[model samples]
Target chain A: MTYEVYVNVLPLKGLLDPQGKTVHQGLNKIGLSQVADVRVGKRIVMHIDANSEEEAKSIAEDACKKVLVNPVMEGYEIEVAQNA
Target chain B: MTYEVYVNVLPLKGLLDPQGKTVHQGLNKIGLSQVADVRVGKRIVMHIDANSEEEAKSIAEDACKKVLVNPVMEGYEIEVAQNA
Candidate 1:
């Protein structure tokens, strides 16, 4: 079965997100002062070939942990579902 | 009320994502060949100060369209929920 695995990679809590801060300052300079903060993260959508939903999730989790995320500075969450 | 707005920004179909292409090539070089494709996107988390959910969603949608997404090459979806 083919499953869709969505991974959200976020900077670890309490980490300084330079990208987010840059955007935040840009927003304020452009008159969007109402936007307090901007937290940017990657939303990766992967199509996995697996025998079951469980297998797909694990594959995605493993890939994310091993390659996609930087464990020292980032954290990730994976959500899996059968593709329509 | 404060609401948490989640935005998923995806490259429009038929548009070339240089970042995804580079990552794909790197993955193939490193021997993660079972992975068919990698589509990169942004999942933005925003705290919206609004009186209702509708307002927060609209704020998020407006920000996404105006500043976050490139309308010619990208599309976005926003989901809103109240902060606990």
Candidate 2:
């Protein structure tokens, strides 16, 4: 079986996001200008294997806690795509 | 009203993702290990205002093209969350 996951990546609270800030500045330069506090993060897609939905979820959750995310700073959500 | 958007973040095709690779290695160390070629990316959330769905989408698409994404290297998809 196949499982697909969606993840949210963000900087640690109080950590500087110069890249995000730079993009915010660029937004103004382009006249999309009104946007403020633009923060940029990453999204990842993964395909995993399991025999049942519950099994897939368990596996994915463990993966996130163990390797996919750093719980102290980053946050994530995993959806076992029904289509998968 | 309110509009919510979901974004997918990824590295340029040829760019190296050392962070992702590191995580992949860590996964192996942890026995969640079957995963290989793990590539990391980001997901972002945004709230926008518009009178109608079409208008909100147009504004968001323009924003993506103009500033939120660098079409040459990055890719994104905007979903207007009905729950918004």
Candidate 3:
């Protein structure tokens, strides 16, 4: 079976987000100060071949640990479902 | 009301994703070639004050067009909901 997996990686809460900060400042300069608490992250989508959703999720999580999320700076969430 | 919005920005389909290609190649070399069709994108979360969901979504999309996404390099989707 083939599963579609989605991973969302973000800077750990409470961590400084320079990129987000830069954008936030830009927003303020552009007069969109109504927006706040901005955080930037990565969303990765991929297909995995596996026997079941659980197996696919495990594989995706393993890959995330190895290359997707940098533990020192990031955290990630993963979801898996059989591809249509 | 404060709305929580999520924006997912991705390289347009059919555009070459060098970052994703590099990661995919790395996976193949590391013996995890079962993963394929990998695409990498950005996820941004923000809080916006708006009168309604539609208003929040419009604000979020406008921000995406103005700064969150580079039209030449990416496309984005925005989702808005009342924040708890």
Candidate 4:
């Protein structure tokens, strides 16, 4: 079966996100002063071939831990579903 | 009320994503050969002050269009919910 995995990798809380800050400034410049805060992260979508949903999730988690995520600064969440 | 808006900005289909390609190569190098394809995008979370959910979503969409997204090569989706 083929599973679609969505991995959201976000910076750790309390960390400084320069990119997000720049975006916030940009928004303010564009007159979006009502936007209180902005934080930016990465969303990675992968198509994986696996025996089951659990297997796909496990694979995605492993991939995230091994390569996609930087534990020093980022955390990741994985969601897996069978592709229709 | 305060609203939390999630904006997902993705590369338009058919555009080359060098970042995703690099991640895909890295995954394959680490022996996760089952991953068929990988696409990487951005997730921007914003806190906005708005009177209603529709207003919050509209604000987020405007921000995406004005600053966060490059419409020439990207597309975006916005989701909004009231903050607790």
Descending-DockQ candidate ranking: 4, 3, 1, 2
Quote each prediction's TM-score: 0.90, 0.74, 0.94, 0.96
Which sections of candidate 2 miss by over 4 Å? Answer: A10-22, A34-37, B11-19, B82-84
Model 4 misplaced stretches (Cα beyond 4 Å): none
> Which candidate leads in TM-score?
4
lDDT of 1 by residue, A12-82 (tens): 87999888787677766776666676788998877777878888788787777667889999889998876
TM-score of 2: 0.74
**Tens digits of per-residue lDDT for model 3, A6-59:** 899999999999988988889878888779779999999888888888888888
Give the native contact fraction of candidate 1.
0.55
Model 3: CA > 4 A from native? none
Model 2, A1-84: lDDT tens digits are: 666655566665576767767876776688764343555676655556667777767877888777666777666666667634
The number of clashing residue pairs in each candidate reads: 0, 6, 0, 0
Q: State the lDDT of candidate 4 residue by residue for A1-84, as single tens digits.
A: 888899988898899999999999999988999999999999898999999899999999989999999999998889886682
lDDT, candidate 3, at B6: 92
Winning model by lDDT:
4
Candidate 4 root-mean-square deviation in Å = 1.1
Winner of 1 and 2 under lDDT: 1
Q: If ranked by lDDT, best first, what sequence of candidates would result?
A: 4, 3, 1, 2
DockQ of each: 0.63, 0.44, 0.81, 0.90
In terms of DockQ, the best-performing candidate is 4
